[model samples]
Target: MRATLIYGAGDVRVEEVPDPELREPTDAIVRVVRSCVCGSDLWPYASRPATSEGGRIGHEFLGVVEEVGSEVSGLAAGDLVVAPFVWADNTCDFCSEGLQTSCRHGGGWGQDGVDGGQGEAVRVPQASGTLVKLPVGEDSELLPSLLTLSDVFPTGHHCAVTAGVDERTSVTVIGDGAVGLCAVLAAKRLGAERIVLMGRHAARTDLGREFGATDVVPERGEEGIAQVRDLTGGDGTHRVLECVGTKPALEMALGVIREGGAVSRVGVPQYEEGPMGVAEMFFRNITLTGGVAPARAYIEELLPDVLEGEVRPGRVFDRTVGLDEVPIGYREMADREALKVLVEP
Candidate 1:
């Protein structure tokens, strides 16, 4: 089997690797049909310590079950499924509390000791808990969208959920990347009356509008903050979804959320120093929440919506390539030429 391997920063290659087999009773082996490149993957691809041995490097995928272990009874061969980025036992306390990302067992993916989905086939741990069965047939064109259910869609949905977005709230989503755009859709589905999306890219902003962004702020940092405030008549929005985990974007989310409002941040934090101002949070009385998304928690609830086409989270994908073309896809994404790239194996 061939998989995407990252040897170091900006160096991703398509390399042949051994196929995976079910190693645990809770495991399932999946024949990947579609996989995607995530912004989160870029972080490690850009900063993980240099390694002499390249490792698998993708986490989001939709595939067909090829085999399942003894304990995995809910799924079987021929079932089409979406694998969440995190693998958990589902019965763990954190999973029960809706924080499966922090599950006590088998947490991270797409790194050392973990087989990622960006290959011909891969083994999924805790299969019954981690994989969501899609109603679409194996030959359905829904694979692209179903793939989004694996990570970005749920992660974006988490931001909205953490911020308490609902029918009465007016939301502001910062960033227009895949996750950010998906946040716009999630906010709409959650019944937000107004959605303000801040981004500069025309294509992405257009997608944001299609997804449900009522307003688009094409500025950065302080200027973007001012625009968001102006839209809300100086009160700011009731809830803000911060999907870009950067210093400027974080500050912007803090600046644009009203004093009693909340900010749900799903972006992977890069700054070691933390938010720009802790005092503002104290004085402003804003509630801050979010981290690695607990995707499994929302899969069952969101799956139906995907099947009904109520939410087209797959709109985030801007390009599709074969596994052999993954190298160019990575470069295109890193250079900001593509929003989300899907790779089929």
Candidate 2:
């Protein structure tokens, strides 16, 4: 078997590796049909310790169940499924509370949770808990959307949920990345009446509109805040989705949300004690919530939309390359030359 591995920053390669076998009765082996490079994968790609051997490097994927462990009763060989970025036991206390991201028994492939899915075939632990069966037929065109269920689609929906977005909410999404664009879709699905997207990229902004972003602001900093406020009748949006895990994006989200509004931030928090604009949040009495997206929790809710073509999240995929081209995809994404890159393993 061959899997994508990054020795360190800017050193991604596909190399032969031992094929994964059932190590636990709860595990299943999935033959990956499609996998994707995620923005979160870049954190380690850029900053993992040089001495730390790069591990398997992907979390989102759609695949066929090649083999299942004895304990995996709900799934079997030949089943097509979407594996969420976070692997978790759906029965855990945290999972019951809708925080599958913190499930105690499962973890994602190549991550703290378990092995990664960026290979020809990989191990998925707690199969029944982590994998969602897609309703599409074997030849259906829902593969792209099914692939998204693993991460971005659910992540976007989680951002909106954390932000408390609803039919009456006026939402502003920060960042034009895949997650940001998905947030636009999530906001619309959640029934936000007016959605504003703060992004400068023409292609991303256009897709943001297609995903239900009613307004687009190509500005940054205070200017961006002003633009969002102006669109919201000078009150700022009632809810803001912070999809970019950068200092600037966080600041913009905090600054642009209305008083008492909620700001849901799902961007992997990269900075320690980054500017959350506590002063503004405190003065305005806004609510703040966001964390690793509970991708597992959202799969059930959002999968139907993807299956029905109500939301075409595959629009975020700007490029598709073979496993060997992952290095190029990483560089292209890091250089901002592509929005999201899908890899066929």
On lDDT, the candidate that comes out on top is 1
Prediction 2 global C-alpha lDDT? 0.87
What's the CA error at residue 320 for candidate 2, in Å?
Answer: 0.4
The weakest ten consecutive residues by lDDT in model 1 span 271-280
Task: Write down the TM-score of every candidate.
Answer: 0.97, 0.96
lDDT of 2 by residue, 1-345 (tens): 888888887788888887889989999998888998999888888887665566777889888899999889889899988899978889999999999978988666786535577778878988999899987664577787788889998889999988899999899999999999999999999899899999999999999999999999999999988888888788998999999898888889888989899989899977788644557776788888988888888888887787778889988999998988888999999989999998887
Q: Cα lDDT of model 1 overall? A: 0.88
TM-score of 2: 0.96
Model 1, stretches more than 4 Å misplaced? 275-279
Task: Give all candidates' CA lDDT scores.
Answer: 0.88, 0.87
RMSD values, in order shown: 1.3, 1.5
Q: Give the alpha carbon lDDT tens digit for every residue of 78-117 in model 1.
A: 9998888888888889989998888888566665466877
